[model samples]
Target chain A: MRDHLAFRLAYRGTAFKGFQFQKNVVTIQAKVEEAFARYFKESRRVHFGSRTDAGVHAYDHFVYFPKAFELYTALGVSKRKSFLSSLNFMLGNDIRIWEFGRLSSNFNVMEDIVSKSYSYFILSSPVEDPILTEYFHWIRHSLNLRAMRKAQRQILGTHNFACFAKSSGVSVRNSERGTTRRIYKASIVSRLHPQMKIGQILEFKFEGSGFLRHMVRNMVGTLVQVGEGKGTNIKSILRSGSRLEAGPNLPANSLFLTGTKIRAGLYAPLRPQTE
Target chain B: MRDHLAFRLAYRGTAFKGFQFQKNVVTIQAKVEEAFARYFKESRRVHFGSRTDAGVHAYDHFVYFPKAFELYTALGVSKRKSFLSSLNFMLGNDIRIWEFGRLSSNFNVMEDIVSKSYSYFILSSPVEDPILTEYFHWIRHSLNLRAMRKAQRQILGTHNFACFAKSSGVSVRNSERGTTRRIYKASIVSRLHPQMKIGQILEFKFEGSGFLRHMVRNMVGTLVQVGEGKGTNIKSILRSGSRLEAGPNLPANSLFLTGTKIRAGLYAPLRPQTE
Candidate 1:
């Protein structure tokens, strides 16, 4: 088996079930692994940096394939299907491989100590942008940006975020494995332009050491409640450490994994961070 | 029927057949007319400022609906479905009405003395962006931007652009009427970002006093040829005034009617022009 290959990819998450493999339903991992078997004539499992929910887009999703790298190097003599091009060609219309490179054999996409950033987009107004419906979450009522900003500040530190996660409805060990996660940064910004007459697009960004299942969505839902003037005491909710105290979880369609900051010298940063 | 109503609208044209009304086909005009009939209990013939082909998006497509305004004013008791919101609620997810206003009784959408702007996006790379596949016209080979710029300048002034129009096979009048059009501004811009690893997005903008059928698409097709080093004597093609001399017409998906520059008192400008 080949070793030491990392791929930076992006996909529109509307079509697949999620990042994980499934039995009968289609998923991102299934499609990608099938592509590998078909194009490279090998079947190796792929490891993802983060497990995304259904309908959550990722602009910087990472994957590690040990045997795929060896297949690329060994097939260098043939020009039929180079590593990146061949895989991209075989994948469906919703997934794209942006960059690929050789990494240290020790590199692990899941356990790498770094940060990741996610953004949730909300279109606030009754007016609809038909062309952008898939990209934005349309909320008919106006949201209080000032209140949401204050709520974001209240949750920007190390805390036992048990309340922000959903119950797995199975064995509870998976949900309790890592409940104490750190929030490095959290803010809400408006991306509205003057030409946009009817509504405004508010982008909420969260950067953290790690995230729990549905944690970001639940936080966004709570922040939205604060913006709606429904939740006044956000610190109490955090202090309560109760999932019932938090607001409902937001939909996954509007969430995006925008960037991932990995350790130095592992791989080149995809783009310069403006913020 | 109410007389003085103008609507500024936009739609993602991937679903509809075209802008015009047809007997059995699903079209933007038919949808809008159906919405008016359903919401206002009246059917009125809608006139569009421009006729768009299938899969052509519009940022600011204007339409004049005579009965829609009457319905709003007559049913002015309810603020909930006011004029714009009522129609928007009735329309499908692929269409949106951005703005509506009362106009002069003599104002006509097709006869207005103004200019229109169009933008065509080209993703010049072999690798595809799955998220952006529906929006951009992907070209695998490298294009000569300098050569295309030169070709754009040659077709800029008042000219008989018969050479750059698609000929309707059935009748000659379809291609002959209003063939003389004025080109106000023409330029090619690069929307490339530092983070983009593989492809470059080139935006071609064309502002003209008027356009013939398929004029913009034909011009884009010819410019692409010049960029590909296939067409050098573009001035001769213009001098010849023959449709056979120009390149083929491009697809409709990549073209967008960015905005229209109407009379100063007609409507508000949608966005600031960077150039």
Candidate 2:
């Protein structure tokens, strides 16, 4: 009987290429595999819940792999706390293992997803703040929040998001699943920055059953244009199903994967067992 | 007759070596002077209210220099707003000139100082946070907040801070001004971090008539030892006037020059004139 382990982690994506495995570039997956190889002295493949883009941060995310129980015994990791600490020590400061536990061998990290929440931060000001440069996208002018919110309302419920996705040369007609996705919630809010007095930070939050590649970013870009009084017709853009009708994709640095829910109740146990 | 200009600026000190000008290395003063030279085509020396160390951020600080009013006209910077925007473009994103105005030539930025406020941030957690790595010092264990506050009370009022000063081989007897200084306020507060849920960010704030070299960092280091139940006698350390008796100087990255009050009322005018 093979035992599996699941991990919920957070990472600052400034130093990583992305969460995917690639050749010759530093990535989150590569680092995790490297740490596992160094600690367990065995090669193992890990599956991620989502493949986040380059420079996209994550406050809550998931990964799972087969656990070598004998290796844990040999390494004296009797508790989940020891296992997390030892793996984190090898993973460096950029990524943190927030929680980990034993899972059934048949548990699938990717297929069990129920919902995903993402947050995009925007600093609306004439000048960029040095301290927040890595985490916020700076705009030179103030945005029309009312208009953006009005546009956000159109994103709720199921819609064919082919227009918002990056074209992969595969026609939507030929794709089995197509580009339809259910957006559970979409909203925007502006708040005073704690450090910068002159600017407001706008948070664009979205929760959905699933999203197409570049969907959230493209939607935000379109809403930003609406906020700028560009007179963008988001409804028509969705109806047209043309990528050209959507606004440009925003930068990934300001985007964050805030939360994810799984059918297996992976995040239900907030506190790891000490024993 | 020479017109003087005064600027209130904020900076994130990650890329700067220090505020003072030095040869062959990057410093805040060096960057400012370079920007001035590039824009005005002249070399001008700037006087800073406080000379902050490398990796120390400042939200409110002062600098003054003789204004090249003629150069502003020559460069088509007719308004103060234009002057600021143009200069900031040259200074890059690390430093921002928040306010600038005409100052009396006799106004001395350094000697007219009434008070200076500094804030130091510490994150007490088992592991370091990657996002806050540039701005906070991470401690592995929980600190005794009550004990730290108790130690903070001893720092108020006039005291000889010679022990906290970095020794320059010049004895106190040979110095023109002794290390005696007046501290108006010393406080420690712990608050939940906005992003990181696992750790509490402790803020140590100090306000004084003046501070000696390495004074704030040294004081914080000693307070940390006391919080760790080291039973550090701050009174004895001050009385001995020995650097070795105090705690180790904390890292500069976590320290910030929050504000400065000038006897000349440099900060009295909150808004800069558009004309």
Candidate 3:
């Protein structure tokens, strides 16, 4: 059996093209693999739990490697500080590995059966936030939070999400495999962060069995439109299963994969319901 | 009388060397002046409320320019959007101008008699926070919050702060001006941010009449040392008035000038004090 290691990682995603490796463009995968090579003096392919798009952040994404455990054992815990700290020191400031442990050879981050949670941050402000520009999607007009919360409830069930998925690159064979997926939780939270110039933060959290390409972004966009009074027929849109009816896919920078397991309890319930 | 314009500005200080104009490197002053040149079709020097050091962010710093009111009058309220919005559009994502109004020509942002507040964020985490690297200073060891809080109390009220101020480039003639200054408020607050991988944020807030060069950073560093049990005699540190006696000056990135006026109310009180 191949010795493997599993780790929980976080990254800003601002400097990276995406999580995947590409020939020339800088990417999270490429930087991570480069760090591994330098540390162990051997090349290793790090497999990420999700192939996130460019500008999509991950606060609790997983990474698996074939020989990470062996390298850690070779270094020996008693000889140095934490393996996570050692790896983090070599990696750039934009990425960090927070937790790590040996995994059974048969386990795969992508194949693990579990749900994942993501949070999308939106700033409702006329003035831009200099510090938060990289982290939030700023919408000048005020959002009707109550309407958005009500719309998200419609998302909490197993349904054919083909209307929300990006279909351009999906294989024809996979399309027939069915686009139905179960959503465990969905909610929108509004918060006042005084320190931020754009003080109003609208956070949207979605947890589901699995997501198709561009599914969450499209869902967020559609819900935002509903909140803005542009799309009122959410039920009809779902039943029709037409991609064209969904809202435009929002930007990737505001989306963050926050948790993998349902019980991770990374986020609390949205408080003081917005009216 | 010449007409002037006043505005509140915010910036992420990661890119620029500092707030003031420099010969070659990019600075906030240079960028603001450049924007003015573009809009007014004339060269104008933008005056700032404070000369911030490298990597220090400002949320409520002021800026003023002569003939700004004249330009606004020319545009009128109907023809163009507010000068603040126009300037923000031309500036990079790291800086934003949020508020603007006409001011009498005699007004000077620097001479305004008001208190200014600054907050320094420190992440008490063994591992780094990828997304917050630019926003916080990461400390690995556990800190004694109670001890730091006690040290901050000593920081309150007026005192000769020579021990905390950096003396190296200070003019020899200005040394006799006396290093004593009034500190209106000082405290350390801890918070748990779920979105940040480094959950513990120890925010240090300091408000006073004015700060000497590197004053806040050096004070925070000394307090951190006290919290770590390395320095115990806070009284001696104050009495010695020797810069060498204080702890190392902390990095500049964690420091943020939060507000220029106490009544601006940009920050809320620390809730449920840390033990």
Winner of 1 and 2 under TM-score? 1
DockQ-derived CAPRI band for the predicted complex in model 2 = acceptable
lDDT of 1 by residue, A1-275 (tens): 23566777788899889989989998888988888789767787987768898889887777777745555566654443355667788887888777776665666655574888899888886677787778888877788889899889988989878888776222246644368778999988896633345567888999988788888888999988988889567789878878888988888988988777767776542221111
Cα lDDT tens digits for candidate 3, A114-232: 78889999887777788888889988767788888888898889887878888533454664436777899998888775864344788999998778788899999999898787866
Residues B1-275, model 2: lDDT tens digits: 65566677789898899899999999999988888888777889987768899898988777877755445445543654567778888999899876666665556654677889999999987656777778999886788899999888998899989889876323567444578888999998898655546667899999998778789999999999998999898889888888889999999999999887767643334343222
- Candidate 3 docks at the CAPRI level of acceptable
Query: What does candidate 3's lDDT look like per residue over B113-226, in tens digits?
Result: 367889999988766688888888988766889999998898889888888889632443664336777899988889764754344689999989878889999999998998
Arranged by TM-score, best first: 1, 2, 3
Cα-based lDDT for every prediction: 0.76, 0.79, 0.77
C-alpha RMSD of candidate 1: 4.4
Per-candidate TM-scores read 0.89, 0.89, 0.86
The DockQ scores of all candidates, in the order shown, are 0.36, 0.30, 0.34
| iRMSD per prediction, in order | 9.2, 4.3, 13.6
Q: Taking the true A–B contacts (Cα pairs closer than 8 Å), what share appears in each candidate?
A: 0.41, 0.19, 0.55
Report the lDDT of model 2 for residue B258.
86
Off by over 4 Å in 3: A1-4, A22-26, A30-48, A66-81, A102-112, A168-177, A196-199, A262-275, B1-4, B41-45, B66-74, B102-112, B168-177, B196-199, B262-275
- Model 2: residues with Cα > 4 Å off, grouped in runs: A1-3, A67-81, A104-106, A168-177, A264-275, B1-3, B67-81, B168-177, B263-275
Worst 10 residues of 2 chain A by lDDT: A266-275
**lDDT per residue, candidate 1, B103-213, as tens digits?**
555565555648898898888865667767788888876788889998899888898787877673213455343577789999999765323356678889999877777
Worst 10-residue lDDT window, candidate 1 chain B:
B266-275
